[model samples]
Target: MKFSYDYIKSGNATCVLEMGKERFEFYPTFHSDALGDFVSYLASVHPLCKLSWKEGAFHKINGGITWETGTYLLRWELKRDFEDLEIKITEWQNPMIDRKGDSQLIRKVLEAKCNFNEFVLCVVKELDRVIKQRGILGYRQEWQGYTFPIDGFLDLKYACLYKKPFEITKKNNGTSLEAELNLLMEKMD
Candidate 1:
């Protein structure tokens, strides 16, 4: 099997790997120290390295392993067939940001160990709840005159889950925003 990988540094950092037509994406949130430690271990064993035991196989080559970094949890999973691998680093506690609802949703998803689709569903549900409670105009007003585009959030969700590019324009009009929210909720269903 051929192995190839690339790291994408953008709004959020991600490492992508491709084996044949199959691709896997990893969101590496590790700080320098934790990442350096993992890389050093990998290099120490060279071509034949077994970092740790996981599900009867070496975690570095197959199976999954998790590391706790006080502030976040770093998880790595390698498929048995070697067709895919994923590494996710997420915060242990929700940040004290103004986006309380968003932060709470993220915390719930991480704590529940939900999969990609589950995560998207959770987001959609939370969005629906918020929209229902506060009409689109009210929701926009809560953002302090800032344009909080739901489509952008949807694009990010789709990209992370499907590993493809997606784009959507910002919706400023209340009618348009409500329509878009309804459409997204329908899509999730």
Candidate 2:
């Protein structure tokens, strides 16, 4: 089976999962904590699932029927969320219903739809590309200093702030020194 995916932002993050000619779109709520969890899950769990299910059993299991079944569930959930959103919107517009209660209900439904596990998985996968491209995982430092070295590159004002002294090697060129100085100044203020 041919599969592809894309992500779009329209007030909220939306993931579009494409399987062959069919397309399924999911909108996941934007929350820092939830997005962090989704990123971690994609970095760990998703690869294993794709290897085990998509490659191993997916092709052999009843000529891909199992994969189709899972897609069916995803489609059903998407449709149900759409219907719920519509109902909530209508209720919110009604004159008899308490305005506050209707608003709350609408928010609740939107949150539920956005937090659905299947939708979240798709979102994580799509976002992983962006995270990787940004080089987020490449930098690993156990301890980060607040100021630059005190030798030639340091600003006298912030030199005392850095407890550990780092040698000003040739690699610490003018551009890097300027960048570090700017960063330190930003932090100090």
Candidate 3:
């Protein structure tokens, strides 16, 4: 995740979440510089060590852990010990955000015992990718959503992705993930 925000405008940006030796990409509403701020939010929110820098890259930008069917599943790995954390699209909540239809998403996060700062990180972290290559969302991960995280209004990018259904070609592993996610959601419900 290299940042050239000095030249880049538009609140929209892309991110690669890394955990222990794994990485995953998600679309964010900010530039590359924002990735560190984003990761700091994760380190503070999730039970993890302090996230920092090792010269240029994130010291532990390695892999990600997402909640699929209530399980902390490891889906990808990183060049470093850490993997990228991801927002599985299977858990997108924009419909609910629309239903609430306001900054109610913010209130939702507060209700979940998250402070304002925490909510911001969650919002950024939960953002879905509009993969440029596919022009659609991909690999939805149904992670746990905090209580009123969506009430405070959302960035249009994240909000809009949820308003429509984005699917992938049948040949890719997309179908497998969709099917598996459906079963996971059913059992979770």
The candidates, ranked best first by TM-score, are: 1, 2, 3
Which model is ahead, 1 or 2, in terms of TM-score? 1
Clashes of 2: 0
How close to the true structure is residue 134 of candidate 1, measured as C-alpha lDDT?
A: 54
The pairs that clash in candidate 1 are none
Q: Write the per-residue lDDT of candidate 1 for residues 1-189, one digit (tens) a residue.
A: 122212312212344433345555445333322222333332222222221221212124333244443344455432221322232334333233233434333221121222333333344344444445554565445433333334334443344334443322345422345534545555433
Per-residue alpha-carbon lDDT of candidate 3 for residues 109-133, written as tens digits (9 for 90 to 100): 1011213333333343343221221
TM-scores of the models, in the order given? 0.29, 0.25, 0.21
Per-residue lDDT tens digits for candidate 2, residues 35-137, read: 3322333222222222221233112211110011111211111222321311111112222334444433321212122323343333433343433332223
Which residue pairs in model 2 clash with each other?
Answer: none
Leading candidate by TM-score: 1
Q: Global lDDT for candidate 2?
A: 0.28
lDDT against the true structure, each candidate: 0.35, 0.28, 0.28
Error of 3 at 128 (Å): 24
For candidate 3, give the lDDT. 0.28
